[model samples]
Target: MVRSKKTEDDHIKVAKDLLLASILPNVEFDGWSSGAFEQAVIDSGVDISLVHQIAPRGAIDLAVAFHKKGDELMMHGYKQENFTELKYSEKVMQLIKLRIQASNTHKGAVRKGMSLFALPQNINEGGQLIWKTSDKIWNTLGDKSTDSNWYTKRTTLSAVYSATVLFWLCDDSDEAIDTWNFLNRRIRNVMEIEKAKAKIKKTSFGQSVFSFFDLLQKPSNEHKSGFPGYKG
Candidate 1:
């Protein structure tokens, strides 16, 4: 499998790091006790359930702190509301947008078009435009001058793998096992194609080299031998 257990672990690690960096700068994580923060929300007499949902954990804490300070900075002045509601207010909404954008900026681990999704760096020896590990096998074995099946397979693997990762990240299920199953199946298919191409290349190379030698023989002997004469 191109993305081994190590690769998956790396993905999680990078994701966590990105999340921490993104959320830490704007919101306080552990300056005060959770009870203190909660108490602050209560004292403000504002409702907080709505704000808790849209805000990242740290942002939620900051919102609670803002409420504790009794600062009507929250757009709705509801103090207990969510980030979305604050945005409904003219000034508070801008703060919410800025913070959310900051959070998203740190989300490099997500596999966006130019995100931090890692591809196999050494999959190709010649630095050709390979997108997946299977591409290396097909490119080495298959004839580029003939059918474009390998190109299709390589593209398919890259597409499926990317889709699987995206699904995994968004999977808010019990164990996120659906994404795991998808990942395993995609990896298996890529490996199978690679093995098949390796065999094909081994057989084809032998045939091609032998044909080359036969072509070097005399033109007059071409009629006697089964091999054809080289026009060149």
Candidate 2:
């Protein structure tokens, strides 16, 4: 799998001049379009040495190597479907918190400075991102015995997070403060729901205990009297 020096250099040059050129900044780059670069490698006929010997020129060569080896380049795309589910423990919570923080900052930056380019449609699908956001939110709270209010709060938090990320991707402003403001409101909604659910669960637990004692009540006196006559 190691590419020759010439091959590696060629890929780097191609990426810099062709892919990263001003004309294609906003364009959607995919696997098929990469064939041109590959053909260039084939033409170079550089001796294939050790797999690791192939110098990694840069992102373009890296992508080519990844394609040739089927390695995942980034943490995006359908590949995430196969990503392992993260444990809902303290560590995972910390990771989500980190993501939340990073996301908020990115949102702010995007709103402040807008992009002139459009992201690929595949990346903008709401359903996929919505589910991802919800999953993260659910994992954050996880089986905490929340009530109706908690459910509402969770939904609000997820919706806002998803919306902010979506907007940030396309925002062309110099300061993406709008996205940050939007996210704060959504997070508050989730907090409210969490509070409500806590109260509801407490009430439910108390009622359950009382019901247990109520079930121990004796039968009515009339029924007891009838049973005595039958025994006689």
Candidate 3:
């Protein structure tokens, strides 16, 4: 059988996945270093040089991909949940919880990833990761808003989700019950704000504001795929 050619996205995913796998076991000692990725190339029997073309930022690129991978996993699990009996709020809660929970095993790796994102230059990359994750979450949940509400919804969620992840990193208690409670409260706050905004938008003043917001809306549906590994 002939070997199939890997596309750029395929190359990115394979290299990142392999690198993540290699790093997680030894992330505490080596962190998300080039050495870790090199070991991944050897460990997974993929081309070692491909790591450069796939992720020039090296560890930071891998870090963003790590979060993006979390989004994919969350989307997959979201598709499998029984949404019929669940309230919309419950669905949102479950979606985020599922994401954080699934990656719980790699807490150490995540901790390192978080620290890497905290770097000054990685700020925009961090924002983009959260934005991509938030956008995907809303899409997964069947959001149809094309207005300012769309922007606010994602903005609020990125804050809530990012805060919850930070809280989760420190909570060593029984099953991170504290973090879940915090997450629920944060989501509730956003929901209440949205409820108010919904009522307000029916008024003339709100409509004008919304019209202005519409002007500020993104022209394209495609978000900036600023992840170094992303080709599209």
Number of the top candidate by lDDT?
A: 3
Instruction: Say which prediction, candidate 1 or candidate 3, comes out ahead on TM-score.
Output: 3
In model 1, the worst 10-residue window by lDDT is 108-117
Evaluate all candidate structures by whole-model CA lDDT and list the values in order.
Answer: 0.38, 0.39, 0.77
TM-score, every prediction: 0.27, 0.33, 0.83
- In candidate 1, what are the lDDT values of residues 1-232, reduced to their tens digit? 5864567546544443343334333333333334434544444333344334323353333422222222222223333334443222222223322222222332222222122113353223111221422343233333252234434455564465446646655665665566556665665676687677667657968567544544443224345232211111
For residues 1-232, what per-residue lDDT tens digits would candidate 3 score against the true structure?
Answer: 9999888888667666776676567666677777876666567665657767667776667767777778788878877878889888888888899889868888888888877778897766677777767777787888988766677778888888889999999999899999899999988998898899889989999988877887765335355344322224
Predicted candidate 2 versus true structure: per-residue lDDT over 123-209, tens digit per residue: 333233333444444544453423443344344545565466665566556565655555556555655765765575579685675
Q: By lDDT, is 2 or 3 better?
A: 3
Candidate that scores best on TM-score: 3
